[model samples]
Target: MTAETHGDRQLAVRLGELLGPRHPVAAAAVVTPEGTHVASRGTDADADADFDFEIGSVSKAVTGLLYADALTRGEITTDTRLGELLPLGDAPVARVTLRALSTHRSGLPRLPKSAQPWRRTITLWRNGTNPYGETLAQLLLQTRDVPLGTPRSRYSNLGYELLGHALARAATTTYSELVQQRIATPLELDCFYVPVTADELRPTALHGRSRRGRPRQPWTGEGLGPAGGIRASITSMARFTAAILDGSAPGTAALDPVAPVGGGARIGAAWITVQVKGRPITWHNGGTGGFRSWLGLDRNTGTGAVLLSATAASVDRQGFALLAEHSLSTGNSDSNSNSNSNSNSNSNSNRR
Candidate 1:
């Protein structure tokens, strides 16, 4: 292996040191711009590591792809009002557009307000986080307080839920169907699925450990389906992120260049722009009840990795940051070897 290879290995080692030891990781895949296999970990043994796990908010990136494809087909514009797309009532819902929803500038809260009752009950029981239906409905009913067009960087599940609903109306298809048709199908991401069950979920699946110290499986049911319900493999995500960086996805040709968000951190559609040691990196991560996953890409190099685990502890930032930094510093791409390692570092504090 070259120096780059060693660097990637070191990064993997560091991640394992931080996140491993009985942490169930189903699959981990890394890829290069040239489509090289690179490094990896976990089981390539078919059923062992190939099982699917919920990718959570990484659903946003998938949703972004759907909207981009719609925009290209002239089906809708980013500035298209949400009200026009969905029957969001006569309450100035048009003030919120697809663009704001994609970039998370919609000023909506994380979940909808109507979810307070169920959420409170869930929290009390230490169950999973409820989906966005009730919360989104509540917020919609009280839009006056949260006005439109105000750019706030709140991570809004409500925004994505709206996007999902709008996309369904605009495309005349459900959110799950649209994601399959627009993103997964084109990319040949066969392992990706939505609204999966615990049995449908892989045993290597990760569980959610709340900030308040509660452990639960993150399933919000079909009502919250579009917001945080997606499961995919590391190999598939690596290819997906690689396509995003390389401009290979169908609608990428018309995409506005990813703009920097915080400092060198840029966001295009749904991908996060990260600058590690001055190297331009674009990536995204997902965490459901127990499963956590990370997708990192060096846009400049068009190389990246998909790290997925069955444990929340497996997908922390320290593990991913070390992997990214190692990928950059050593110039190696050992993404084929599967296994796992991670530490919950502040590397991606912005999104988490």
Candidate 2:
């Protein structure tokens, strides 16, 4: 068998093994100098590469890119306060700086307070409905009464929600439009999008399931788009990872580590850099009520991996192992094999 075919088969097998006995639908991809390798586990109707999955907080990584791009365009600065762009009035959140927001040091809670988050959480657990379906205006109103805690390196979905909208406002556009015009269109990620409501989801969007196999509602809302509302197909994720690795993605500077985030890791905007297998791996993981996802990249090796599962389960370890294995296995392949494989993969990706 051809080496490329053999490699593809091996990757598929490994993905299946890693997934093992759980998760009704999942997709994975690895990018190397020899190009992208993709695999999925599901029935014929749902296994296509174009099937969309909610990416959850990985949306923050995209928002991070936008934040850095805004900085470059002179539309915002690290010190820019929320009040400068968003209508937060004299609220404590309005005084938070953009840099602090990006790095999760803005002292905002995990979810908007105006949404009656505690009750929503109970409703989500009982009814499998979305807990973060607040509108942008609702989110802003919610922030008005939120008391800020001491700023530290804390993860906050609310921080990103505001940061993204503030960045969009700085550019004189809405957050969804900013994402479309800047990242998705420029990268040709046809299925990459932020849905403001459940009805906006494409037909191919997969229904995620809870751990006990209960169907969960799609997490979509105007206020949540920057935090956990974005969705994309596996192919789009693969292409996005490739762009990030090659430094061709806009706002690549967002991946540079700027502050420590404990556990010997550093934060770069929304991305996290941690030591894994003795190499610096920049990554971000996400989970909604129904889905879980992980994306990791070793820029030094020019290798990256992404895992998307329709069930709410951890995939971080599997993602790291996949990337490490791919990096090691292809580290010394001959130039001709690498060229041929990369050509094939790139051609197929472009055709999609």
TM-score of 2: 0.90
Error of 1 at 30 (Å): 0.7
Q: Candidates' lDDT values, in order?
A: 0.58, 0.80
lDDT of 2 by residue, 1-352 (tens): 1111122566667767787757657888899987898776673443334788998888999999999999999999999999999988888888999999999888887765666677876787789888777899988998899889889977788899999999999999989999899989999998999999988999889898877888989998999998778999888899899999987788989999999877788889998888765567788888888888888887888999998988887776777777777765666432221110100010110000
Cα displacement (angstroms), candidate 1, residue 46, comes to 5.8
Predicted structure with the largest lDDT when compared to the true one = 2
TM-scores for all candidates: the values are 0.75, 0.90
For model 2, state the Cα shift of residue 135 in Å. 0.7
Off by over 4 Å in 2: 1-8, 46-49, 330-352
Residue 121 miss distance in model 1 (angstroms): 7.9
Q: How many clashes in candidate 2?
A: 0
